[model samples]
Target: MAWNEPGNQGKDPWGNRGGKDQGPPDLDEVFRKFSSRFGGGGGNFNKMGVLLVLIGAIIVWGLSGLYKIEEAERGVVLRFGEFHEIVGPGLKWKPTFIDEVYPVNIQRVNRLNASGLMLTQDENVVTVQMEVQYRIEDPHKYLFRVTNPDQSLSEALDSALRYVIGHTTMDNILTVGRDKVRRDTWEELEGIIEPYDMGLRVVDVAFKEARPPEEVKPAFDDAIAAQEDEERFVQEATAYSRQVEPQARGRAERMLREANAYRERVVLEAEGEVARFTQLLPQYEAAPEVTRERLYLETMEQVFSNTSKVMVDNKDGGSMFYLPLDKIIQGGGSAPMVEQAPANRQTSTSSSGARTTSSDNSTGRSSVRQGRN
Candidate 1:
């Protein structure tokens, strides 16, 4: 709505718009709104005044270019889209809007976790979870020295992870020295990140858990359990053998050795008895009468010790003597030999001590019948 419109006219003392009906403003109001606002005429002079005012305002804004950097951060100054300088944490300034300041945290560290299931050198896949801690070393280099700085971390981490896992067996990744693997991964990751000028230094890497993936977890667990059981069984069997076999062998050997020693002792005793008997045989031979008398008395005593039997001789002249042999034939004793005696008994009397025997048929035995003899 232009003010010059007739409907927009203000009322004066006669009820009309003041400025529009009055046609423009006083010259002093124009001068006051013009030169005071830095414009002279509609010519080049007015344009110069406007441009000068803009330039002066820009100068004032440029002088106020100051910022405070925290203790953990540094300022990267850019002059004309190029690296101007790197400023430490403090009150610092740049050349107004001409120089851009990028504040980068240098003291504080950042952490990231790289975790996944990956294949190992043994053609087995395992789940690996871990954390990585890093800090920015050179802030200026961190911003400009590397392209896609933030994304570079994952690539370097992947490189390190792959390198570490690729060289490790599945078992080692799942157990044993997983901590050392994480440390090695951090060092390798730092090396890769550093070369790219990502301004990241590795503080540490920790493995949360590394194990067989879910698909093969059961199989691995079963295998481990089976191995332990097998080892236990082997140990038990070995211990049983170690405990039982030696004692059994020792017992058997002891019994055999004892039997052998007893055999040797009995043989030595028999040999000694035989030698003594042989040595006494000559003495008995030289004194035949006395040895015979003593033998007779000893035999008589031994024979009568268990029985009251007595030998009787029947004095029938020509008749075959009927011997009373039944009395000596009773009880537990060696059967005494009897003979049908006639001429042999008369000639062999002294040698047999008045007893004789002969080889005969049943007729000789009838003479010594149970009741008849």
Candidate 2:
């Protein structure tokens, strides 16, 4: 039956007999009644609920502090806005809202480029570009030693590059001096950053490119080409000298050997002549006239050995007959043989004290010569 029926008048769901209207149950009363079933009073139940809420808040705060750091990174911990400690890679924990962690990649290499048109020592302007490779050496110094280490390094690079370039000439910077410029800039950069303790380590400095201004590029190109040509010519000349020197030395050595040989031969021949003369001195002293005649005959034989003439002695007179043996050998005809004339035969004598007569032979006509007695 409905509670509002006449028979059920003055009765409600909560077992109240009065017919007055009833509103919803009070929250406190409901809690009190629910707590009563759990063997605790309302006051104790409220205390337990407050404790549970505090525990939940503590758990959340603890979980928020857990973080992971990669292998290449180092975590810098700051407690209450002050540097506390440094932590390595892996899972780490810090008090939430009380400590801050800044992760720095210590293993990564950073690059900075500095380039511009700068004046050189020779009052010439050149465009220079350089690249600096660096990495963090100390996380603490990198983060706290300077306001901004990266920016400071960048500025240092520029300053060092400018200083090096300003002390170098345009020709060197654009050509052979680039390597020196890079080395000097690296050294100067290290010196500039060392005292600052910025915790940055320079890996390398490379001179990217150096060139004259566009307006003068063509002229510089020509100069560079000429310089290269000069070097090439010098190298070629050096090689030629190296190659020719040995040959010239060898030729000179050969000539010296030949001259020495000739000198020795001449000296030996002269010594032989002297020895022969000494041996003949005894013979000449024993028979002066005969030795003199033999010497004259030997000398004359030696002198006429190379000639084409033949000499014949007249036995009955102190005269000589001459004939061109070489001409006769060349088919000019043999000399006529002179025969002793009989006393009855007439003889003709020439101015040279030789009798001459024309005779005919089987071959051809010949002029016969005879010495006068």
Candidate 3:
């Protein structure tokens, strides 16, 4: 009953004749059967499968080409390994394995430092440190214009620093000349980079430090201190001069004004004397004796105005008088009595009396003649 039995050998499980002699099913028949199950004929199945494969391939290639750029970045596109257009930040598409995109961050600032012991114009050695802040201005140039922009910038910084330091002095590099050194270095760097077009812009150049060699540091410090002292003294002297000069000028001006006033007063007084004498000349010439007597009295009045005086009237013709009034006043003693005159001459008194002066044993006599009315 089994199909593999000798009698059933000629027939297969599917009831086909000579089944043992038949190999596997025919390729054309298998294809026909598989296509019929999917409701497609043989040729249409092959074409549809090929179309689906092509579409999948195209989709994979397109997705592979899609890339993104950040807000701060720029894309440098290279088509077929050759330079192409630069693209801004956004979703970008390029042929897969054909065009390449290199994203560069243009907004970021980069820093480089250059330092070395350099020689100055005066042949002095100084260690100088400088820092350069820079940023990429052109991403294309930064990527292609120069093999390495950063390295180039660093070299330029070194060259600029050295050149500036070479032209400057050690004292300036270490002290007040720091700003000048930084500025000069910046200018020199810009000049050097300008011709290269490295697409790098220098933001700032900072002079970090400049110092003498360690072996001479102590001596330099002493020198710097001495320079500071000298400056301080000069400033103090300048301030003192500023303060004192004005006072001296004011005093000198005051003295000049006083001298001028004194001169004016003396000139005026002399002129007044001259004028008074000129006016009196005619009067004196008219009455010489009277004028002379009046002048003598006026002069005497002026002379005795400020002194302590004793007045004595010589009523008798002759008399001896003695007085120690100065000693009596100093010793707080009594005054001496007046002595009687001799009887030979008559005693006379005038409305205006004559004055006689006497000390302890000395006497001074003065005569006066009354003027006629």
TM-score to native of every candidate shown? 0.47, 0.60, 0.59
Q: Give the TM-score of candidate 1.
A: 0.47
Model 1, global lDDT: 0.69
Best candidate according to TM-score: 2
- Model 3 lDDT tens row, 1-373: 7666677656775547855554555788777888899998778889999999999999999999999999999999999889998999999899998999999999998999999899999999998899999988899899998898899999999999999999998888876788999999999999999988988889999888888999999999998898889989999999999999999999999999999999999999999999989998999999999989788766766665443443344445434444444643674533322323234422222112222232344434322232111
Ranking by lDDT: 2, 3, 1
- Score candidate 2 by TM-score against the native: 0.60
Candidate 2, residues 150-169, lDDT tens digits: the string is 88999999999999999998
RMSD (CA, Å), each prediction:
16.4, 11.6, 12.3
**Residue-pair clash count for candidate 3:** 0
Itemize residue pairs with steric clashes in candidate 1. 9-17, 10-16, 10-17, 11-16, 11-17, 12-16, 339-357, 339-358
lDDT of 1 by residue, 174-264 (tens): 6556877887898788778765767777777878878787877898888768767987999999999999999999999999999999999
State which candidate has the highest lDDT.
2
